[model samples]
Target: MAFAWKAAGITYNRYLAIAARVVRRSLKEGPRLQAERRGEMDLRFAKWQNGKQGENKSLGEANASAMAEQAKAE
Candidate 1:
């Protein structure tokens, strides 16, 4: 069986990119400022397999990268 998103034909990253865009657009200035800062916090995910944490890239970086990729594809 295919994954949920795969079955729907959208990758998880694409889903997240769309969601982030919608959320950012929905926020107003007061909360948007706080949210953007929260978004910029460098967070890393770690699973036991590699015994190493992932690189420190902010959500802003990921969002920017996704936007850049979409821009290039257009």
Candidate 2:
């Protein structure tokens, strides 16, 4: 059987994100705040070139800009 998210043309990551958001929204005040904190993406990444690592960058910032660029292109 085909998955509903696949039928909707969203990637698995996107589907999970949507489901998580729904679950978080269903929580009461205090627990909802904690659950939202858990959803935060505090990730760091670095580029590698010629066997060397570059300075670390915020993954959230990277993804935001990438999505922005893609929107502009589209």
Candidate 3:
């Protein structure tokens, strides 16, 4: 989550605020804003998963490792 925030330069809460703004503006502009928001979110996730430029393993792999450890512990 911290990595996600750093990758986006905005925390989840800040993203929510931006989302609210986008929604309000979208009411006047229509559904195009939704696509824009989705694109931006995808870019942020990609950046986080890639680690500066996707040079590292994906977030899925990270989460999987964590889950595997937890299962082993149990």
**10 residues in a row with least lDDT, candidate 3:** 41-50
Clashing pairs in 1: none
Candidate 3 per-residue C-alpha lDDT over 1-74 given as tens digits, one digit per residue, 9 for 90 to 100: 45665698887888876777766666745576665665453112244444556545556676789999999999
TM-score to true structure, per model: 0.37, 0.79, 0.30
Superposition error at 6 for model 2 (Å): 0.5
Best of the candidates, lDDT: 2
Q: Model 2 lDDT vs. the true structure?
A: 0.97
Superior candidate under TM-score, 2 versus 3: 2
lDDT tens digits by residue: candidate 2, 1-74: 89999999999999999999999999999999999999987889999999999999999999999999999999
For model 1, where is the 10-residue window of minimal lDDT? 40-49
Q: At residue 24, what lDDT does model 2 achieve? A: 99
Candidate 3 overall Cα lDDT vs. reference?
Answer: 0.65
lDDT for 19 (candidate 2): 98
Better of 1 and 3 by lDDT: 1
Q: Which candidate tops TM-score?
A: 2
Query: What is the C-alpha local distance difference test score of each model?
Result: 0.75, 0.97, 0.65
lDDT tens digits, residues 1-74, model 1? 87777888998988876778679768999998777776654654433446766665666667789999999999
Best of the two (1, 3) by TM-score: 1
Q: Which residue runs does candidate 3 get wrong by more than 4 Å?
A: 1-6, 29-74
